[model samples]
Target: MALLEVHDLVVEFPTRRGVLTAVDEISLHIDEGEVLGVVGESGAGKSMTGNAIIGLLEPPGRIARGEILLDGRRIDNLPYDQMRTIRGKEIGAIFQDPLTSLNPLYTVGEQLVETIQTHTDMTPTQARARALELLIEVGIPAPERRVDQYPHQFSGGMRQRVVIALALCVNPRLIVADEPTTALDVSIQAQIIALLKRLCSEHGTAVMLVTHDMGVIAETADRVAVMYAGRIAEVGPVKQVVKRARHPYTHGLMGSIPVIGHDADRLTQIEGAMPRLTDIPTGCAFNPRCPQATDRCLRDRPEPMPTEDGQVACWLFEKEAAHV
Candidate 1:
């Protein structure tokens, strides 16, 4: 069974103006020990999807429709307190900024030990020991001494490592990591990616890695889901999606990446910005900006259709399938 399953999820905010749908009928799944990268532009609902899955969607923004399941059990409709218990124990989360997640007043050890104790039946002393072990596992040097320090004492990279440790403290089956490396320096970003990959592999934990950085997705994710205007444009194995993208948007994203040896006069860019949630275009959300869009694309939305190796939500693909 899939470790994490999201089916037709729709997240929305009812404001004075009107209801704004931030996420629109998106569905995907992550298997055991798999890294599913949700990549897109800033407002592409990547973080919102993660928040919905982890039961952290802020007030006014909620799961308007559809279901979220973890290990075959439905979780989207669970009560707040019940979902809280499931959050840290069954599904962990690592966000973009470590400082925002960590408490400034407490020692790192205190926070880790508290989380471990809350989820497990371990004593204070046992929890402390496990906390230290986690610190070491995340590659924090001098964990014995570092564990006693506050969040402010660690560097950006090290603090992120601490956050990773906190997420894994309860041995969660799945993790929702939203731009975990975005706040670090480029050099540190690579290290953190390697660390996350190694730790997840060793623990056999599934990860829903949400980011806008295609480079990071290429490096760490097993499969890639390209989202556009709060919908999935294409999804498949990372290599296939990266090298032979079937959807035009995915192709544009891959083309935008800079090559080391190949120097081009200018990098490829997808024309026009993503439409605002309130102003989403009719029919295919991407039709306004899609170069290959036809009259049908402007009037009718296309659901994800099977491709040779994956699925693409495009009329072009649908027509091709019909001819075949």
Candidate 2:
């Protein structure tokens, strides 16, 4: 069974400008031990999608439509008190900013112990020991000594590891890591990715990884979902989406990446900037920038349609033979 399922989820914010849709009819699933990558440019709603799933979407932003199911149980729109039991216990979140997520006033050990104890029946000493073990498991040095350190004392990478450790404290079936490596260096980025992959494989943990880096998605994701202007343009297995991308937006993203073997003087780039959330185009959101866009694309929105490989929400892939 799929560990996590998000169906037709829409997140919108009411601003002075207008009702800005940050995530529009987005849907996907993650199987046990599977890593699903959500990639797009800034403001494409990748992080917002993560926030919605974990019941952490900030004020002014509300889930206007659709459902979020974890292990076949509905979680979207649940009361805050009810959702608290699920968050960190059933579905953990490793946010983009580790520093901001950690409590500066508490030691790493205290936070972890509190988390574990609050969710489980473990005694204080037992929780502390488990916290130490988790720290070491996530690659922290001298787990015994480091567990007592404050968030400010740890380096960027170490802090990220601590965050990971806290996320795993409850043995959550699913983990939503929204750009968890964004604060670390390139070398440390790889390490964190590897650690996440290893943990998922070992524990049957499903992951929803939100990032703007296509390379990171290529290396870590079992499946890829490409979002543009708050909607998913394409979704499929990693190999299919990366090598045989059907959507023009997905193609543009792959073209922009620099491969070790493929040489180019300058990286290919997608033209035009992201339209304001309050001012999304009339038909297809990506139509203004899509090279293959036609008059029909501007006149009418294309519904998400299934293809042989996966799914795409573009009219260019409408013909029966186009996807074959």
Candidate 3:
């Protein structure tokens, strides 16, 4: 069975304007030791999906309907304190900015030790040793010295590595990484991606990687889910989704990625912006931005139907003959 399953999740915000649906009946899963990349442009609900899974939805936002399961057990409905325990023990989260996950008041070792001690039964001395090991494992220079330093002491890249160390300290079954490499430079981003892939592979941990960069998803994810305005446009293996995108939105996204050797006058651009939650378009949320959208696309929403190798939520692929 998949390690994490998000079934028809609906996250909404009660606002003065009206109820805004941030996540609209989106469902996906991450298998054991596999990385499922959730990719989209801003306002596509990728980060919201990740936040919902880790139970970090902002106060005003709440799960209006649906469920999130971890290892066949429902976690979305658990009490805050109960979910908190599960979040640390069964699932870990890595955010785009490392500082948000780290405390400036605490030494790197202290924070690591605290999380370790909170989730596990390790002694203070034992937790410290584990923290040191984690620092070394994440490639922090001078693990002994750096462990005693504050979060501000590390460079952006090193601080990210430290956050990674904390996330993995408990060896949780899954990690929800929301734009985990965004703040770092290109080289450091590659390193962090490689580190996440290698570590997850080595330790048999599943990951839900949420990012707007299709390039990063192409590198680190085993499977890709392309989200569009709070819904999944397409979901399949990385190569399939990247090379043979079925949904127009997915195709537009793939075409926008510049290939190093292939020259083009300019990258493909999807003309329209994703709709705001309060003003999502009818039928297909991406219809306005989809170049190949039809009359049916503007009036009839297409549920995810089977593709040759995956699933796509587009009327163009509604029939078997449409499979490429």
Highest lDDT among the candidates is held by which one? Answer: 1
Query: Least lDDT summed over 10 consecutive residues: which range in candidate 3?
Result: 315-324
> What are the lDDT figures for the candidates, one per model?
0.92, 0.90, 0.89
Ranking of models by TM-score: 1, 3, 2
Question: Candidate 1 — number of clashing residue pairs?
Answer: 0
Order the candidates by lDDT, highest first. Answer: 1, 2, 3
- With candidate 3 superimposed using the best TM-score fit, by how many Å does residue 315's alpha carbon deviate from the native? 0.5
Residue pairs whose backbone atoms clash in candidate 3: none
Which regions of candidate 1 deviate over 4 angstroms? Answer: 320-324
lDDT for each residue of candidate 2 in 1-324, tens digit (9 for 90 to 100): 677889999999998977888999988888888899999999999999999999999998999999998889999978999999999998899988877889999999999999999899998989998998899789898988888889999988888889999999889988999998887899989998899889877888889999998888999999999988898889899999999999999999999988898778999888998897878888998888989899998889877788886789998888952646
lDDT of 3 by residue, 37-113 (tens): 99998888899989999899998999999999998999999989999998868899999997566888999999999
Of the two candidates 2 and 3, the one with more favorable lDDT, higher being better, is 2
Give each prediction's root-mean-square deviation over alpha carbons.
1.2, 1.4, 1.4
User: With candidate 1 superimposed using the best TM-score fit, by how many Å does residue 82's alpha carbon deviate from the native?
Assistant: 1.2
